[model samples]
Target: MNSEQRKFEIWRHKMVARQIVARGITDPGVIAAMETVPRHLFVSEALTDSAYGDFPLPIGEAQTISQPYIIAEMTQALELTGDERVLEIGTGSGYQAAVLAEIVFRVYTIERNNILFLRTRKLFDALKYHNIVARYSDGTLGWKEEAPFDAILVTAGGTQIPQPLLDQLAVGGRLVMPVGGLCSQELVRIEKKADKITTDNLGGCRFVKLIGEHGWKE
Candidate 1:
C-alpha cells in the first residue's frame, strides 16, 4: 500500500484492537469489515486525521458518521453470514452501509437529508460498492418495498423502533438500533424468530436524531 493507505491501515488496526475488540466486540466478520472500509474516505478531508479516532465526526446536515466502535458493535449485533440482505437507515456518510456491504450480499440504505443522500450515493458508486443501494427518502419509515431483510441497522437514535421496521424483519432476522429519548439512547437488538420477537440491550449510545414521518420532526 502507498504511504497514506499504509497509515490508515495502522490506524485501523489500533482502532479495532483498542476501541472495538477491547470493548468485547469479537465477531470476525464485523471486525473484518471495519478494517476493510477506509473510514477516512467516508468523512470530509478536513476531518481525515480524526476518522479513526475514538469519536464520531460531523458529516454536515447535522449528521455524524458514527464512531468506529459503535459501528462494530451494531454490525456484530446483526450477525450477518455473507449471504443475507441488509437494510440500513441513516446513510450519513454511507460508511455504515459500506461496512455492511463488505460482509453481506446486499444493503438497502436510506437518508432523510437530501444533501447527504445525494453525496453518499455518488461516493458509493466511486467506491464501487455495487451491492449497496442508496435511497433518498425517510429512513425512519424503513424501506418497505424491500421488506424481509435478513438484517437491519438504524444508525440514528430514535424514541422508539418503528413498527414498520419490526414488521418487515424476516423470520430469524435481527434489527439493531438505539432506542430511548431525544438525546441519549440504549443500543438494542430485536430478533424475530418463528413469530416471536425477542429484544436485548447492547448498552448506551448517542446519535443524530432520526428524523422523518415516523421519527423526530424536522
Candidate 2:
C-alpha cells in the first residue's frame, strides 16, 4: 500500500482497538468489518482526515456519519453470524451500511434525502459494494417488498420504533435504533421472538430525526 493508504490503515486499526474493543464490543465480525471498510472514503474530501476519529462527521443534507463506536455498537447488537439479509433504515453517508456489508450476506438501505441517496449510491458502486442495495424513499415505511429481514438497523432517531420495521423483522431477528424525541434518544434493540417481542435499551444516543409517514412529519 501507498503511504497515505498505510496511514489510514493504522488509524483504522487504532479506531477498532481503542474506540470499539475498549468500549466492550466483542464481536469479531464487527471488529473485522470496522477495520476493513475505508471510512475516509465515506466523508467529504475536506473531512476525510477526521473520518477515523471517534466522532461523527457531516456528510451533507443535514446528515452525519455515526461515530465508529456507535456504529460498532449497533452492528454488534445485531448478533450477525454472516450470511443473513440485513435492512438498514437511513443510508446516511453509507458508512454504516458499508460496515454491515462487510459482515452480512446483503444489505438493503433506504435514504429519505434524494441528494444523500444519490451520493451514497455512487459511493457504494465505486467501492464495488455489490451486496448493498440502496433506495431513495421513506425509510420509516420499511422495505415491504423485501420484508422479513434477518436484521434491521435504523440510523436516525424517531419518536418510537416504526411499526413497519418491527413487522418486517423476521422471527428471532434483532432491530436496533435510537428512539425518543428529536434532540436526544435512547438506543434500543428489539428482538422478534416466536411468541412475543422483547425490547432492550442499549443506552442513550443522539441522531438526526427520522422523517417519514411512520416517523416524524417532515
Candidate 3:
C-alpha cells in the first residue's frame, strides 16, 4: 500500500488494540470486521483525519457516526456467526452497517434521513458492499417485509425499544439498542427466546434521536 493507506492501516490497528481490545471487547469476528472496514471513507474529507479517533463525528443532518468502540460493542453483543441475516437501524455514515456486513451473511439497514440514506447508499455501492441492502424509511418501525432477522441493531437512541423491532426479531434472536431519555440512554440487549424474552443493560450511551412512528416525534 501507499503512504496514506499505510498510515490508516497502522492507525486502524492501534485503534483496535487500545480502544476496543483494551476495553475488553474480545470477539474475534468483531475485531476483524472493525479492523477491516475503512472508517475514513465513511466521513467527510475534512474529518478523515479524525475517523480513527476514539469518538463520534458528524455525518450531516444532525446525525453522527458512532465511535469505534460502540460499534464493536454493539456488533459483538449480537453474537453473529456469519450465517445470519442482520437488520440495522439508522445507517448514518454506513460505517456500522459495513462492519456488520463484513461479519454477517447479509445486512438490511434503514435510514429515515433522506440525504443520509442517499449518501450512504452511494458509498456502499462505490465500496462494493453488495451484502448490505439499505432502505430510506423510519427505522423505528423496523423492516417487516424482512422480518424474523437473526440479529437486529439500532444505532440511534430511542425513548424505548420500538415494539415493531421486538416483534420482528426471530426466535432466539438478539436486538441491541440504546433506550432511555432524550439526551442519554442505557444500552440494552433484548434476546427473543421461544418461551420468553430477556433484556440486559449493556451500559450507558448517547445517540441521536430515533425518530419515527414508534419513536421520538419528528
- Tens-place lDDT digits, model 2, residues 145-209: 99999999999999899889999999999999999997899999999999999999999999999
TM-score of each: 0.97, 0.99, 0.99
In candidate 3, where is summed lDDT lowest over 10 consecutive residues? 155-164
**When superposed on Cα atoms, how far off is each prediction in RMSD?**
1.0, 0.7, 0.7
Please give, for residues 69-157, the per-residue lDDT of candidate 1 as tens digits. Answer: 88888899898889999999888999999999999999999888889889999999999999999898888778889898898999988
Give Cα-based local distance difference scores for all models.
0.90, 0.95, 0.94
Ranking by lDDT: 2, 3, 1
Winner of 1 and 2 under TM-score = 2
Name model 1 segments beyond 4 Å from true: none
- For candidate 2, the per-residue lDDT at 20 reads 94
Candidate 3, residue 132: how far the Cα is off, in Å: 0.3
In model 2, which residue pairs have backbone atoms overlapping below 3 Å?
A: none
